[model samples]
Target chain A: METILKVKNLKKYFGRVKAIDGVSFEVEKGEILGFLGPNGAGKTTTIRCLLDFIRPSNGEIEIFGYSSRNPDFYKSRSKIGYLIAGSNLVEQWTGYDHLSYQEALHGESKIKNELIKKFSFDPKPKVKNLSTGNRQKLGLIMTLMSEPEFLVMDEPTASLDPILQEEFYKIIRKLSSEGVTVFMSSHNLAEVEKVCSKVAMIKSGKLITVQKISALEGKKIHSVKITFSEKVSKDLLVDKNTEIQEEIPNGFELSVKGEMDAFIKKIAKLKIESISIMQANLEEIFLEFYKK
Target chain B: MIAIIKRALRDRFIPFISYSIGGIVLVWMYIALLPSVQQSQVQLQDVMKAMPEGLMKALGVSGVNLASLEALLAMKQYNMIWPLLMIFFIVSFAGGMIAGEVENRTIEIVLSSAKSRAKIFFSKYLSGIIYLILFVVATTLCAIPMAKLYGYEYAAPNYYTLMYLSLCFGLAVYGLSILFSSLFSSRGKVYGISGILFVAMYVLFILVSLKDSLKNLQYISFFYYYNINDALIHNKIDGLSVFVFLSIGLIASLLALIIFLDRDFAV
Candidate 1:
């Protein structure tokens, strides 16, 4: 278990506004760590600090046991790839020109053509002529082509169509399987949950919790819907973690916080026609953290 | 750094060629017309005699003979047309260099690379200097062939002094443009602010030249050191002038490097 990146008490402030207030996290090798937060939740800020695109107001980031601010970090940089949201490419040149240029910078590419074929974007067309999604594809190729061991992506799949998004996921899956580490930020909870080994939920520039995807199972509440054959008192379920959310003529929706086995057995004793138990998604879990 | 220079060159190369063509036209028009203008020199001098003394001095034509090909070409080509072309070239180039990248959100990608901000800034600045030399050399080369074809009358003008002045003057304006570019994030604002500053400086230089009491203002105006006709016609390379312009360029670029390196890139 190699700890490739370590960020400690990171704080970045714009004037008086603390963009990221004392965020601390670590990413191990070959793991997909999802940085989950809403729009201004310091996700991009944290990534920018990690990449040294901007200096942190206070704190430090270690990349591969070296300070991220090290003058020789370039040696480590060759092992890292990043895809920026709304990438800026030379519009006058074709996508291949950008690919060749970046390849030259990072040395010869091992996966350039493979990623191109996988993403399916025209490399011959001028960048100005490429669609937003295609430009995103070109950006993806530019970053992934070097076959870097680590990837820091900021909403890499936002502009792509659903099919392309799936393609991006497949590529990430393949990359992760090959033992490449990834640190990505996304408000796309389902996609993050589907692929991320672990998630760090952040709100208002503070880390709420870092949980394994499975650990979220009982750590947060799940919403449950039950329809009874007849009107019944809310007391039919005796579990304290379960509370009726919306009452219906014949059914009620309950928010269940923890384990539901006790609540389910109690509800089963009462004649229930049908029951559907729904688990809270990552976004809901995040909202709960915000409330707390 | 190499990648960035390639991209910057890709962006600036076409416009540079077009400007060179425009420069060629100006150089050819002035030099190719020199022989004929020399023939009408007496009449032209006569026509110039009636002009008011104040107007002549303001136009920088006082004590300058329109009869010599050197004087006429120096006034028309070196002082006015060539500098104008160089000003636009350097201003737009410097304006777009880093500021353009920042505005387009492209600097983020470039910054993500292993290169330092200083590396990026210096590489692009060096390319601009190369372009400046090429542009100035091209114009001078265009003039030499045409002057030979047209049989330039006066003693072959000092090519070295002309080139030196052009480089110095180019550096001066280029420095201001890059400074403005580094100061502003928006590409258009870079151009707009530098353009406004250039015009203001040019105007101030004119007013300072016209008013004996306001001559001290020349210290701030780049156009003050950009006396190309004085440098060419007199064969006088002012060391102070060269130092001032080059220093302006180097100092401005230094400030740009400092600010660019230290500033947080919002992109």
Candidate 2:
């Protein structure tokens, strides 16, 4: 895959605080990458540096193979759509006015009406009158309407309701299908799991891991429940590899990691009647990653 | 650059209209009432006596023939009306420009556009110049009829020079205020710093007029650039003062643009 954005030893300082320290990552074209971190973990700082709104104290950023430090680097930025962490809109203008101004700035004057209606925003009402959800929708419309090659959003779904959140994911998925690269920083693990093919975990301005979703799937913990026709001996079931989490009268629940084929064969030899396996949820995977 | 100017013009039309119209009406009323006050012997001397010596000096009223109708009109229009209007409009408009964008978080959207910081700064300054020119033109139009009614000779030459000096001084104040706007991200801070600086300079002008010991401070105030008596009544332009004020405005605007280009948009 072609690289769309490249960062080398990116760092940012706020007064005495090191907001981003030696962070490096690459976003590939046509990839939906998730940037996962806790609050105040330098997600927004990295995005700001990428957009060239803030200069990096030390490091380099290359967007579409152009240096971000150049004064004319902003020309490349016009091809990018960004929704910052907070909803920042001119309160005096209507949602339509904001979008129109953005459109004019991008030189995309003939945006389709269907595109505007997709977000379900009332263009007539001023931004101050809109709720947080509606305001976010307005930001979403502004970012998505240009149909740029890359979408850089920070916590894009934070203020959105569950239904709107799903709708937003649909749009993101559509964009990904159309080969637009998306780099979104979010704490919502479930949302990330739904669309992102790759995930990068950050903690305290440092990158912890960057792995494919398939690699993370293997690391997922599964809860296996087995029922035997007869009572199973606890001593025989005791194994260091597979943890026997709980023991019932006729069944046992075990939390297994890695490949469970051998563990399932062991259960098969024990005259099992019914067996059920459930993978760990996204939140559980996030917590387990953090715990490491 | 044109786009930026267009945006500024659309956004600032209301404030421009309010200040210009209010200025013209106020000056016209003052000019018309001056004749009536002059005809009544009691009102003229009483008004002159009540005017404090410090106030007269602060307003730059000295060595002028007050007996002439044109001189009194020049004093009222140039000393009082022009400065007040110029200070209020430029300070208020410029104080809100950058600080307001930061407060509203619109700077992010603006900077994210295709335009550079230099372009944005130039466009904003251009818009200020346009507003100031429009004000000068409007005030001239309003004063023409009143100048004729008052039987003031050489009214054209007097008001023309007055307008020129006013424009130059107005640009200086606007440039200073724009510099203040770029330095501070908060609206209150910009307004406070700019207002205090203006008042302090005016106070220095007053002090310099009071004691010969403080005369050295007169060079600091932009107000010193204009000799209302010479410019308005005698139609004499001080080339050196104009050069000083223009240089200050140009240098200040250039510094402001450089600072804006380097500083990050806080929003």
Candidate 3:
């Protein structure tokens, strides 16, 4: 796939605070790249820099093959749809009014009705009267209606109800299927894992890792619960790969980090009646990554 | 640029109407009260004594004879009322121009569009000028009947000249406020600084009018542009004052545009 966005050593500072520090990443065409980071970990700052909302203190960003230094660099932004972290619609205007204003700005009148229906938003209600979920839906509609090539959303599903969240993912998936590149930032690992084929983890303004979802599946750690016939001696369970996570009267739980074959065989030899192994979920993976 | 002007008009039309009507009413009421004060046969000195110094200063009373109805009207209404209205409308309009977008977080969306920041600034400033013209026209129309009712035969030329001077005053204040709006990101700061600058200039104009020693300071105040004593009462427009006022607006607007083009917007 061709690279859609290339960010290298992107750094931004506000006075003494380094908002984005040496962050590097690339987004490929037709790829849903998930940007996962905790609060204040530079996700929003990175998106802002990408959108040219704020100038970077150091480093470079090239979007659609144009360097940010070019005077016409912002023209490339027209191809990207953005939903900033917070909902900032005018309170006095109805949803329809706001959408119409934005449509006028873009000089497009084709997608109004389609987007209104797609997001299931009530156009009659004022923005101040709309609930958080509906407000997010309005923002989503505005961004989506632009028919942009890439969607750069900062915590797009935040403040959304579970049902709306599901609906949003469905829309995102639909867009991805249509060959629109999506760069979504979120703190929810499961949300990103559900929609993204590839994920990059950022921590404290620094990128920790960028890996494919399939690669992470292979790296999955599992917990094994073994029920032995008798009390297993400490000598019998002498394996460094499997660490005891929990101890019971008749059984013990072990977290297997590496290969599970040798540990499973050892448990079988110990006259274990039953054993259960479950793959660690995304939440656990995030915790482990942060713990390290 | 047209789009920006349309948006500004849509947003500020209500405030513009309210202020324009309020100005007309205030001027009419002040004129009506003047006849009553005159019917009571109160001494001019007594009337002046009844008014506080702060009230006179705030009302921009200076140089004109209070005995003549036209001079009284010029001092009480034309001299300060239009200037106050011009400053209020321009400052309030300008205070909200860029700062309102920042407050609403819509600046990002606007900046992301095909239009450049300079275009946006110029368009909004031009819209402010349109509103200012509307305000001067509204006041001029309302003042015509009031002038006839008071039997002031010279009101036509004076009112026309005052409207022209108000336009110049509005342009200077509008440009100043736009400069303030671009310099500060916060709405409160923009309003506060612009308000203080306006009042400070008015005070300086008064000081220059009160003392010959301080008369040179008139060059510094935008209020000098609409000096009714020289323009309406004396029936002579100070070409120097008009030139200075227009130059200030041109320089300030250019500065605002330059700063707007280069200044980084907060996300």
> Which candidate leads in lDDT?
1
RMSD (Å) of each candidate, 1 decimal:
2.9, 4.2, 3.8
lDDT for position B35 in model 1: 67
Please write out the lDDT profile of model 1 over residues A79-179, one tens digit for every residue. Answer: 78988554578777788788887876778887788778888777998988988999888888888888888999988888899998988889899889999
Model 1, B44-153: lDDT tens digits are 78877997764465455778987766677676777666767888888888877878877877777677777767887888888898898989878765666777777765
User: What Cα-based lDDT does every candidate model obtain?
Assistant: 0.80, 0.78, 0.77
Worst 10 residues of 3 chain A by lDDT: A84-93
Instruction: List candidate 1 segments past 4 Å from native.
Output: A218-220, A226-244, A250-252, A260-278, A281-283, B50-55, B154-157
Task: Write model 2 residue lDDT over A62-174, tens digit each, in one string.
Answer: 88887877778777677788884335787777877777778767766455466567777778999889999888888887887777899999899988998889888998898
- The Cα RMSD in angstroms, rounded to one decimal, for candidate 2 relative to the true structure is 4.2
* Interface RMSD over true interface Cα atoms for each candidate: 2.0, 1.6, 1.8
Of 1 and 2, the candidate ranking higher by TM-score:
1
Tens-digit lDDT track for model 2 on B1-267? Answer: 776677778778999999888888876786777657567745655665677776566665554556555576666776766776778788777867787777666777777776777877788878888998898778755676776776654367767787787777777887888888887777788778877888888778777777779777889886667677777778888997789878888888888888887776665
Whole-model lDDT, model 1: 0.80
Residue B213 in model 2: lDDT: 90
Highest DockQ among the candidates is held by which one?
A: 1
TM-score for candidate 3: 0.86
Tell me, per candidate, how large a share of the native contacts it keeps.
0.52, 0.54, 0.44
lDDT of 2 at A6: 89
In the order shown, the candidates' DockQ scores are: 0.51, 0.47, 0.47
